[model samples]
Target: MEELMRQQQLSNGQKSERQELTCSVLFTNPKFRADKSSTKDEINSIARMVSNAEDLELDRVFRKVSKNDVEETRSLNRSLFEFGHNFEDADGWLKLEQPCKDQLATVLRYMFESHLKTTVQIEINNMYFNCHFIVLQVYSRFFSELDMIPLLVTLPENAVSQKAFMLSYKWMLSDEPVLELAHLVEVYVAATYLRITSLEAHCWKYFDDEECYNEDTACALYVESKDNPAMDVVRNLMLTRIRKFLLTFVATKEFLDLPTSHLIYLLDSDEICVNTEIELFDGWVTIGTRGKRTFGV
Candidate 1:
């Protein structure tokens, strides 16, 4: 009986060890599997987000690079055409300095005066100009359409004066062109007729200066440009100036010399101010009397 009891106790201990092993496997297996699956899903989500962000960043970089490349190409093309004296650097590349650039422009102007490689003859107001087709094409849209080589281009009579054309030509060749106030009006008119938009815009900027105009100049400019639709901006600016000094202007020789229509136009503006109605009426009568005297009416 003691032997039987020992065998039974040994069998009971084996059963308890097997039960503990089964319980540990059942509890740990499910938790480990769940943890691995959840970790893998989270890693995949983060990786996808990181990839999208990288794509966006790369796209932005590419667009910026493309824009810079286009701008650099345009700048290079302009530099190729611009007059510059090139000196080889230590690295065997060419570079330019301000003095060298000025010297180059001077040389080119001398060549132009010497009539070297002149491809076209431009006639304006009985004056003739020997010009390079390429140079004219660069400055004027009107010249660009004339594809024929060794041509003679004649401008309409009274379209632009000889002095104005010369000034415009100088402006085209110059690296830095100054529009003197004395010659500004004629040059602006010449640029308009030539279809040189850049020079036209440059001349317009001078009118913004208050010192560029006064009662006399304003009246002259108004009469000079009133008929030109392209010069309407300058015409209107002069009109505004005239109105602002209307009382003082009417006493000036310019107002008395104004055409009958221009005098009426100024007197008709609502913006015109006077100290009294009688003063305004008196100014009008004075202009009318001058007009009648001039015309012997």
Candidate 2:
């Protein structure tokens, strides 16, 4: 009877150990078996609307958004996509689609028509933007930090133009005008700097090699993004295209305007299309002389 009891005790211990192992396995990789709930998927889908790279880059350039703010922003955007025209669900949670758009349009119309009811003055590179604080604040976290009355803010060097800012505002209010190709670069830089995730993503499609291949345009974009470490990827992409079109690039105003160091760096590239040292020297002289004449030096 003692021997039988000992075997039963050993079996019970093994059974407990097996139970522990099973529990550990179940909890080890929760994501692999996470609940297949629609709520979780809904939040995740909006979270992925803006890519990690773009979000991180925006935060690096602009100030970082709080975790709560980030979640709220994503939720708000999801609401817009899921339900247009500012409709609310049974839970009474509001989506800000048409309401914000209508508000913005009214405010802009008022401001432009010289009504001057509730406008804030924002300064960017000697240009003044008299706009409704609420409207501007609604779309950009950068604007939200302003201390209210007639707020003045200055953007960094080579930031957005007045047109780009207005266009971005329009896009935020209503997805209209459809992201004009002519204003893409300025709008992209502005959206990124202002941490406007939607506008940034919208403008991103214009940066692909096929659309941005022109030598002057590519070189100009390359120079503009070179200063910001967050924009290194964009700068490198432009550089690649510039090298691809080296022959045409050498004669362009953009190439002429490059600092001597950059010009020398380009001259060193084996991929440059010049057939001989003489041709290379001629190209160099042409760029330098054109730069001098253009600048009236």
Candidate 3:
């Protein structure tokens, strides 16, 4: 009986030493201290290797005891089970599952949704937004200037519409924000006003895609882009599309609804295609008459 107790005690001592060694290796290992730039796959791979190493160590310990020593084997088995349970509860490995951006986005999203630590309120077209100044300053140069942010700030109704402001707010809180095609132009305008260059760049990428433009959007896009000197690229792209599909665009109500300046701009494009000179002249006359009646000119 004394021999059995001695063996059990030895087993207990070994379990304690093994746990300490595991912890030391886990905490002290350079690979375990995940770098900020490490991908999720890399971090998870490291975690799996560490877990496998721990299992091997436990198995090696179990093999040291004789099969006939039932009590000692049982004690070691119980220790291993308890260790695993405690380790799982610690959740150290589980934390590595999310990449840094995802983890940050999760926390930021929670904070934004909960309205936690909000330092400023922005009003747009009677809609109010509670925002964190720290977060805004990070993404927006307009907000970064100390004098620009105030307790209750109101945006100019002419510059940013309520829906556009709401979408921009969503962009600020998300790692990967989605912009709706319907509001793409408005959101781009808001992003520009806010001086959120990253958001502006993202919007430009959408504009640069030929697939994003079509007959329904092309006329309105041209009207919106024509006056803005900063939107020269977008205006040129619309011109290119109109030139390529002149007859199709001329048939749309949106084309007839174009302002006189915009109609003239389209007429002035030397690259515009038509089946014949007379066909182009008739289309221009129809568009010109519609512009005159609409503008009451």
The candidate that wins on lDDT is 3
Measured against the true structure, the TM-scores of the candidates, in listed sequence, are 0.54, 0.43, 0.54
C-alpha lDDT of candidate 2 relative to the true structure? 0.64
For candidate 2, the clash count comes to 0
lDDT of each: 0.70, 0.64, 0.72
The CA lDDT at 254 in model 3 is 58
Q: Name the lDDT value of residue 196 in candidate 3.
A: 90
Residue 96 error, candidate 2, Å: 31
- For all predictions, the C-alpha RMSD in Å is 22.2, 30.1, 24.1
Better of 1 and 3 by TM-score: 3
How many clashing pairs does model 1 include? 0
lDDT string for model 2 (1-297, tens) is: 999999999999999999999898754544543565444454454456555634543323333356677632222223454555543333535553445355786767656445377467767778776666776677677787756545566676467678878777677656454888777767887887887776777666677745654466777677676665556566666665665567776666666566554555566656455666467556766757755634321
**Per-residue lDDT tens digits of candidate 3, residues 1-297?**
999999999999999999999898865655555455333444455557675544444433333334777434222245566556555567577667765555786787788768898999899877888888887889888888767558987898666788888888888877778888788878878887889999999998878776777544665687677776556667767876665667777776656655566656666777677656466656766666756654543
Name the lDDT value of residue 236 in candidate 2: 62
